[model samples]
Target chain A: MSASPGVWLAAIFTLAIYSFLYGDNPVYKFSEHLFVGLGAAHMAVMGWESMFNRAWTPLYTKGEWWWSGAIIGGIMLLTRWFRPIQWISRIPLGFMMGVAAGLSARSAIDSQFWRQIQSTVTMKLNTTNNIVYVVIVVCTLAYFLFAFNEKSGLGQGIKGVGLVGQYMMMIAFGASLGSTIMARLSLVIGRLDFLFKTWLGVLK
Target chain B: MKILRSSVPIWLGVFGGSIVLLAMFIKIPVHVGLWSKWFLEWRVILASFALTLGAGNLLRIHANRIRMKREAWMYSYVTIVALIGYTVLGILFKRTHPVYSFIFDNAYSPLSATVFSINAFYISSACYRAFRARNGHAAVLLLSGVIVMLGSVGIGYAIWPGFNTMTQWIMNYPNSAAMRGMNIGAALGIIGVSLRVIFGLERGHLGGE
Candidate 1:
């Protein structure tokens, strides 16, 4: 039994990519260059497609010349190249900044401030699981609270909370690190599996 | 002084932020949602342009390296060559062309794999150094990491069926809660940073305006 040409090609490419684990070599170098070239080309095409779809067609079809502002703005963004004309880029930059600021301002209340406060205040501690969560949250929040002194008075309560938060944060960070490690290991394992099944044809 | 007076970003940031804030609470169809969407779209467009700015910076830095004959000049040459080679090939041969695809398939894919593979070694070293069981929670973290690592490999399954269960429990319960909390905090920080930019406190993007 044999695989198709496409399968072989995929296997070869996979091997070529994985070869980099051995160190900097010809296969890795070749693959690296190819990736950059293709990625850049893909991005350019996508940009053009976006501009045509989002900006140009709407204007031509609906007689909405106002959309040309976007085009002009985009072109202005390119002016960062020319020394004297670099200032022109600021036009697009400013427009973008204005729009982003405006949008974020509108959404911040719902997404950031209000929602966070609501979630923070609305936790139920009736169940054992909920009690544990409440404790973690309270401790963590207290750990971050810089308003009180840690040495005395109400500061003692704050200090206790801070200690719990510190421990919880440490544990959380370690777990996060462990998960990230596992993910990388899985990728390597997948590559090895591909080597065996696809390249060597030993598995299947 | 004249330049300072005509600062466009500051005006845009302040006025735009205020308008957006006002628009958020408003029910008007014309002024609220569309305005925010338009702004987001513009930001995306601008972000694409910023990528070019980043590339230009990369080129300048590398070009300067070549000119100065810096240490490991050969690596710099290689970097410059690789960058220029890809740019030219894509421009000349059309991206979808077999030659361009060959470069992407053979060159880029391999490099990406190679970079990711380096993470394997780094993780090993980092875990070796950092996975000390100094406290009770630290001990749990260490044990969970060991299980997850083993389960991720084929060896954990060979050792015991329970490794998978333990890893799942650790991830679902403690890991998810912690990750969610961190993610929420990050979101808030990001929102704050964006707000600062909107209010003209961060003029770094304005190129020192």
Candidate 2:
């Protein structure tokens, strides 16, 4: 079956955008704004859609009485426009913050602290890999004990530990950077290939 | 007297904020009010305005760079040209139709992705340098790194079953614990900051005199 008009149009447009990889051109800029404007428009429409489907229709047509509370809360979110009434907007902000805080507090306990200690304490030493984990944990922890002076025994120990942590962090950062670059290159290649093979039919 | 002057705004902010919080739990059988909906929508509008301001700032900075003929002025020129070109095209075509779609899939997508793809080589080099065993703690880290790395590839399975198990243990246990603790602290801190803002105790964001 042949491709639909919409599909062909989208494919051609995609190629137009891909032409940008060679250098800065008019086509690339056009694509960039198209993405931004579409993104903004989509978000605005989504917000309105949610409010209509969730609040308006339910309350007006179906007579879902409880929706009034949501409508009130949502309206309160708009009070920031009037300088005199701006403080009224804080009502929803407070509720959002409170809920967010509670959720984060519970999640944090399970994910960050307890799990870290559990892993550190039950570490393996027999295998080469386990040995590295054990060392990293110890050294990284040691590096953080900065209460002591550099010349003193305790100070020197903590400093040494911090240095190890620093090294590990640097390594991680470098790896992250490399991955980012590779990702970018792949995108460029992908775009180029799409333009040439799909739209122009120059290469298969 | 001075504290009261500063505290009035804080009290109002806090009071309004608290009411909103209370509203969430009170299922009064009545539909949620229009006030909540308005508040959310208003925030989106305000946020959009702020985004426009940010874009303006970016443009201004680049324009200045070109005018002054600063180092890498050509790059600034390219940025300005690109920004204007895209903005104009979006306005002119005025639709997500074919003409507009062509620019998006080919240009912006590639730029964002190409910049991100260059990190793989940098990561490999970084990893090699980091895995060196200098001390007891360093040694443990080195060991964990190797295990995790090997486990990620098929080699760990061929080498030893224990390597994969150990790597999983490290990630599941210690890594998670540390991450969780940090997350908890961050949540608490966020709540505190939010409360302060609600109460107007934190006026720093407002840029007060």
- Across residues A130-168, which tens digit of lDDT does each residue of candidate 2 receive? 666566556555544545779987787678776765555
TM match of model 2 to true structure = 0.54
TM-score of chain B, candidate 2? 0.78
| Model 2: DockQ vs. true structure | 0.10
Q: Which ten residues in a row have the lowest lDDT in candidate 1 chain A?
A: A33-42
Q: Which ten residues in a row have the lowest lDDT in candidate 1 chain B?
A: B176-185
Off by over 4 Å in 2: A1-204, B1-40, B134-137
Q: Write the per-residue lDDT of candidate 1 for residues B11-54, one digit (tens) a residue.
A: 66566566666666767767665665565665665565565565
> Against the true structure, candidate 2 has what lDDT?
0.53
